[model samples]
Target chain A: MDRPIGVMDSGVGGMTVVREITRQLPNERILYFGDISRCPYGEKDLETVRAYTIQVAEYLVAKDIKMLVIACNTATAAALEILRERLEIPVIGVIGPGARSAIQHSRNGKVLVLATSGTVKSNAYPDAIRSLNHNFEVTSQACPAFVPLVEELRYKDDIVTGIVIHQALKSHMHSDADTVILGCTHYPLLKESIRRYFDGRKAVIDSGYETAREVSSLLNYQRILRAPEGEVTHTILINGDSSRFKYILRDWLPELKYDMKEIELKV
Target chain B: MDRPIGVMDSGVGGMTVVREITRQLPNERILYFGDISRCPYGEKDLETVRAYTIQVAEYLVAKDIKMLVIACNTATAAALEILRERLEIPVIGVIGPGARSAIQHSRNGKVLVLATSGTVKSNAYPDAIRSLNHNFEVTSQACPAFVPLVEELRYKDDIVTGIVIHQALKSHMHSDADTVILGCTHYPLLKESIRRYFDGRKAVIDSGYETAREVSSLLNYQRILRAPEGEVTHTILINGDSSRFKYILRDWLPELKYDMKEIELKV
Candidate 1:
């Protein structure tokens, strides 16, 4: 009951999921491992992404976490099922929850998924939503440029961010989807621009927020939810220099500031 | 960093504050002691309220909390300053944050505070808001029956709750207070009906939410926030049978399920 929740992602983008989980489950401690050394897992091959994800998951499981949350969409697309099968604890992913939330908010039966190239190509969200409701119209738009811009903290520069969003989403601008699922956790940081671009016509589904809800629900159903208790110091690990990881924590979640530890992944 | 946060309330209404604190600072464990044996501190004399408040405060202080939150408005009105002066850790109250939030949200310089009779009589919010800005119009309405309705779980019954609200605020219907500060934590539970009664014209300032933010800011500024770490189970102690407390927890926050311990207060 006192074990922390384990979460792994490719890079700081998963911090969005971390932030939501913190907000939703404040008493539960988080054991986060951001594989910054091998980030851009979204651009890698299927087997490579799965291998990297498993390595990180194994590290978190070694930490004796009560549950596991795959905070990255790309990793979820590649390795979620296998990780669930291997791990003794409950495993959660962002794609299914985001799809479910978008499905809930969508009025026109039309939904769009904004994700990394890997997730879009993998058809994770499309498959998840379709399996639940085959007739629901789903569009997966890959904005490959979003990850780099967000990582560089260029989301603060509205002009450049707007241009990138416009250029990337130009083809799908005319589509009348009432809901847009932010499949990439990083996209929520650019929600204002995305909302403005659509003139507030579409409801942006932040998969991170939905994923937090799902984790809480899953833990509750399993009767293994952490009881609210003492001061919990979250553990953050990276397989590289902690400098960039530190900057991301301050910028995204100043309230949850903590030093990141360097770890050897033996890659 | 692993010390618990002390929260003292007159009765179950402050569970609303506990709920927000749990949501806002999920990683930090809460040490809550509700005086269910002598609840409705709203009806007590100032000195009596102060004594009871101090007793609970001292108990929590002994529990070695890093900070203290006065979760009840009546108790805050009566004993916040004394408690702060007496305690070594940072101590916070619901009134100031609610007043500040109301001032921030109000456009017409018109604000109404819905509080228990004790708080209204003490003029806690009006004085707090006006002390910051002298020209702002402030009205404190005494919802004498609200606490009981909420405590008895009558708020779940819309008909009685609606009639009680209507009867309580009949005279203020024409008054254009664009911001309604929920001075009593219990008032948040009745927010939907209150909003509907006002036809969504007034923005509800949930003091509990604002108080949670204040606690976070204070802790962050003081550099005393609990680092997110190992599992932490919150300690909840009530000065009487905990059957009602359990029911309220389930009703108000189903996601947060934990056992409440019964304790002797010797009031």
Candidate 2:
């Protein structure tokens, strides 16, 4: 029960959720797996995404992770339920928390979700929201360029990020929805660009923060909350070293120091 | 199409919606009716609330108003559909817009809806939200003391309103929800207090702004948009003069000046 919580995503993007878990539940240790070799899962078919997610999840579970968190929306939409049925530990998905967060703040009961094409094609958010409150109107757009914008740290270069974000969300500029969800885990890195484009006209939400809250809630309700006085440490593993897991995380979360390990994916 | 838009609420609380409309659609003229004598309709039963809303809507229709807006959530919950069916002009409700806004901004997918016991009992927001996206998790709590808190201008005195708001929302302090809906029209007046209590953890959305955006969208879509170049004037009417309509309106929106007329609700 005191084992580290397992968190996995397609790439360094899952760091967003990792950072939140670190902030909200400081006492808990984290075991994060980034399938950096697969990199952008958004472009893959459902089966491929699921396979990659399963591989990463299995790796984390073997490491004796107590809980599983699908930090990437694509993986959640593709593999969460299956992993839940297959794994004994409690499983959490980014989409659910993000969708929940978006629903909670939208004043018009209308929402604009910006994820990847795979997520949009899967109709993940709409389906999830419909199951929770079928009366909400959902609009989703896939931003193919966003993940790169964040990974390259282009978001820090506002002018370029703004252009990409505005172009990605242009059609829904004056959408009936006055709130936008950074549906993809990586989208949180593009938060400034998203906020600047909406310019106070809309509220922007993220799954990282909400998912962290959920992790905290689940931990408490299940009576597995780590002791506050205990020393907490975290581990990051990447399938390949092509991705900048440490550099990006350190930039966004300079407060935490983490040592990352590079591991091989059997497949 | 050039005629004034009709807006009504059980009391001056609906003025929040009116103010939003005035700000968002500056060129459109508004004719608002507040049944001040029947203030605090949150305590009334559904049938009575429905009847009161019908009468008010009818009165506005009789005024040659182009569009009808049920600015009170209770009235909208009780009568929006029926009135929409009965009236030829477009009908709008505060609840739908508020729910939409809340859904759009919530990061946790959990929403805390604060309204009068009557509005909460009517289940208007939940119904409307469910109609759009059933996946939302909604929590509705009625604050019987909120209307008076705003009407008495207690919010201006943070020390007073903060205490009242904190007490009202304390039970849901760590609610799974990361967003709060100002479910009642008057609750917009209590926003700062509500925000302060939640700190920055949750987004506080007001139906007033959402309703205004909806009105604007409806006008454009219905092709009833008034020419911006035309001279626009507004009128406010209350069933009783005992209410402090002028003082509150002027205090909140000094830029808007409109003559008031006294009317009566037969029942």
Candidate 3:
């Protein structure tokens, strides 16, 4: 019951999920792995993403994690099922949580999903939404530029970031959809611009927030929730250069006290 | 795997949860039991609520339900732990789902829970919220009149309904809490008036909605989600007169096709 949760993503984008878990379930420990060296799994082939995901999962499993969360949309689209089959712990993905959030928020029964090209190609969002209720309609758009913007920490540059977001969303801004799903983890960094694009008319969902709530529900259901009196600790493991990842970690979690280490993962 | 989910309530209040499960997971079948003869368990003692809940749960279990949902807050506060200990199938309550939702929406880390007298007395919401994060501040108010308004079908009497809601919430309207939880399943029927009382300043969370989403997440996690191609059905069983319950059912779910029956419960 005291085992730490393992969270992995292609890069620091997954820190969004980490922030939620820390804020929502403060007593539980977390082990985060960012595959920065092989970052941008969004453009990789399904087989390659699955291979990289399984490699990182195995490493975390050996270290004794109670659960596994695939924070990368592309990686989840490629590897969620296979990981659930191979791993004994509970395995969760971003797509189902995002889709469920969209379903809950949509008033017009129309949803728009914005994700990396690889996730869009996999049609995971549509499948997830339709599987819940076929009456709900889905539209997907691939934002190939969004991940790089977040990875390079250029999301804070409002002028340049605004242009990139506008270029990707302008065509769909006037669509009939009443809810937008931030299907990729990196997309949350650009949420303000996306909300502005829609002029605050539509509900914008952050998958990390929903995924964090799901984690809380599942932990409580399984009776593995850490007691509030326990001391909380966080360990972040990066498989690539640590300089930029460290910078973003500090910016996103300014008050967080955590230990960061550079680890070489065999994949 | 195709077994119907069993939902029980002290009275018709739980129809709100059934409505959500029907909307969110359209493929799954549901069997609802409303103990109308022993209605309004909110004013009853913990021992009495637990005894009544166990009697209903036993009847449902004999029918072979895959899961049991305690859709009433009072029943959940009293019998949730005991039911989990005794039942082999998964048992979920509304309190945890509501608490998680308030945590997700509260910007100031302060939440207000509006529930029945029994739920407030049990302190389940505060405990559930604090168990997840000690930083959260929870305040509970026992709205003893809210259930009567919903059950007697007087919620539509805006003048009378408005007075009752205003009297209950006027004192806490100026509090630092940024989120309001409709902790009782019956409270959602009064949502519009409650929203107006706050002047649209705070986030209002409906426990039934969050509970349905958790049900969906758990079902998916356990790989027991019914396929979309399967037919969906609903059955309502009442232990008392069905005249008013029938009227409310038609009013709340106009398009929902279902069957209703009157049954005598031993308890």
Candidate 4:
């Protein structure tokens, strides 16, 4: 089967996952969809989230993807179960991988989840972590403004960013967590600031990396791993503009060559 | 008579212009398109830029927009003239407005143009500035990595961000320019950092704001300004997902409610 592994996010934030996926499964071609149109699913209602999630999933399925990775935390929280049930292929979400990693890595058994409002409200990470290790204490913080702040590329604005991160991490800082799970894929973009904020106190976990590992394991277990014979290619589809998305891929995956093509997704 | 103004960019960066246009022209509704599919037109070649620009323009024109704002700098440089000639409606680009603003604001008649490699290479701002005032000395710098850095939301990652910005702006810092025009739409997302980088030494001119002003003027000149009677609404269309885009919009334009709708643009 030469079909590609499908990964989707609200925007390029999922590129983090696609980058990891490429690194881990170099032989497997990946199809990544960034719904840059309806991105930052953090603040939308559940119905709207489900609608967009289905739209993207349907579009990717139409592309003949072998598997689907809900690379977005918000979408995973809102529609992962539904997608897994509805789609023919196996469906994976970032929440489980990230939560499991946090659970496995937490020294103090207190793990902090930094994610969008929708993710936190759904208790997706907390539930995933608890299911893996019942004794793990998962504290979730809704960093509603972080995505936009990052999206707007305000990462270097010390004063504004410092204030925002400080506000978002205030509750987490007071908690006894020794490891932080970047629940949302976009959170990795703010890793430096996040690490600095919790500097020396906690280890920051990237969902993208953990999810990639999971994908590798699942593919191997299913005996679906492609032989590293053919040249590995990654096709990135943006239902918006491919210009900025290409640059983002270059920045995040530096080693990978991004072939961004425009695709119109019917909602 | 109640038709909305069509504004398009490679990605969400154009929301800066959309926000301004909304603020300035409160009576007019906006049908905004962020070609999130092929965004960040800065690094792409001319042929690619022209093709993408025309694709977006045709999509917007099909929506029956009264005017078209090529809110993206690279697209403006690559396809503004072609669009103006091809379309029956008045077409405005950020370059002219940005140059006009830079010329008007520069106290010493020495202005700096900061944009993507494609836009800078096109000499769009320089051409526009010279057209307005021949004596104006315009220094242009291609901040290639800036857009990707911003898109990755690494603007707050102090070390990496500082290094990138320093490298991109190093050449311009040594110059005699007093006013720096953020020639690219995406550049505005990095405005705070860019401003902080050149703190107290120069005034940062945002092309989006200037473009909005020009858009207002053109509408007024064309006698197409909608009467301020009905409720003013803004419809945001993203070719990807609306969630993340909404987050950024809420942060950038706090007061406006962003009704995000998914748009499938036929290329």
Cα deviation in Å at residue A163, candidate 3?
Answer: 2.1
True contacts kept of each: 0.00, 0.00, 0.87, 0.00
Given the true complex, what DockQ would model 3 score?
0.83
For residue A73, model 2's alpha carbon misses the true position, in angstroms, by 0.4
Angstrom error at residue B72, model 3: 0.3
**DockQ value of candidate 1:** 0.02
Task: Report the number of the highest-lDDT candidate.
Answer: 3
Chain B TM-score for all candidates, comma-separated: 0.97, 0.96, 0.98, 0.93
Tens-digit per-residue lDDT, B166-227, candidate 2? 78889998877888898999988878778878877888889887777656645643558666
For each candidate, what TM-score against the reference?
0.56, 0.55, 0.98, 0.49
Each candidate's iRMS in angstroms? Answer: 17.6, 16.1, 1.0, 26.3
Question: Where is model 2 more than 4 Å wrong at Cα?
Answer: B1-267
**Residue-wise lDDT of candidate 2 within A121-140, one digit each (tens)?**
99999977654445588999
> What lDDT is obtained when candidate 4 is compared to the true structure?
0.79
Interface RMSD of 1: 17.6
Better of 2 and 3 by lDDT: 3
lDDT of 3: 0.90
- Assess each prediction's global lDDT (C-alpha) against the native: 0.81, 0.80, 0.90, 0.79
